[model samples]
Target: MRSALIAGTLLLAIIATIFFDEVRSLECYVCSRQEGNAEKCLTTTKTCESDENACQSEIRWGSTPYWSQGAEKQYYVTKKCAKKEDCEEYVNRFTSSCQRIWYEDWKCGECCQGDRCNYYIIMGAGNLKATWLLSLVTAVVIFRHIFAS
Candidate 1:
């Protein structure tokens, strides 16, 4: 009986801790195209500033001559942590569409909430957290209520 009571109390404490946990700042992929290498951005991540709640990505596409046969197209990308408002304004600046430059280069950008949301140039927020902790707490609460009654 004593062991059962102690276990129940421990479970409740764990549940309460989870409920009162501090909120974490959003994390995002952060890098820029350097020396024509955009892939470097894929390996770095940053915990965004408290006010920087969004992930932003910009992609630039252009055509380059391929020696003889034809012109090959290529794109460079950049990613960073940003504020939602700034990202929204940028995405909306072009009427939600890519802008054409020099008739060959196209520039596009996007923003998203959640961690690593800017990992993809065009994708939105990442997957949400699982709810198994909530379910476990609920189950424990019900068990304790039944035991007390």
Candidate 2:
């Protein structure tokens, strides 16, 4: 019984370590339009208007407006590009350039330039750590039970 208890405690400790280690945050780039006109494209003032009803809505998630702040009123839009390569591709594909900015945690930032800019934010960590830790603990428990007996 003492041996079993010790083994279980060790197993739990190991599982906990792995669980914490695997619980890393993941960042994704988000862009949004600033609350100003085109002439002030250099301004970095913007805010994310979250709509619980439209969390999954496919509307513009970034600050780039549909219409240009310039003549002809052509609209410029922002898209979420996870990878740097993807961001570059977006700029190239859309015939528009973008400034990439890094953001920590899950908080959103305002637009920086051209009524829009790239910002990074945490999306979700999921159950990866828990799953890994559980598997490890189960394996350790089985090994100890079989070998000790």
RMSD of each: 6.0, 13.1
lDDT of 2 by residue, 5-113 (tens): 7667867777686655434322222333323223323323333332110011011223333534442322232223233343334335533222232221111222111
State in Å the error of residue 62, model 2.
Answer: 32
- Model 2 worst lDDT run, 10 consecutive residues: 51-60
lDDT of 1 at 121: 72
Query: What lDDT score goes with residue 31 in model 2?
Result: 32
TM-scores of all predicted structures: 0.59, 0.24
Candidate 1 lDDT tens digits, 29-145: 887753232467777899988888788888767664343445565776778889889988987785444755545657777887766767667654443423335647666776776
Query: Total clashing residue pairs per candidate?
Result: 0, 8
Model 2 residue 131 CA deviation (Å) reads: 12
Task: Give lDDT per model, in order.
Answer: 0.69, 0.35
Question: Can you give the lDDT of residue 73 in candidate 2?
Answer: 24
As for candidate 1, its clashing pairs are none
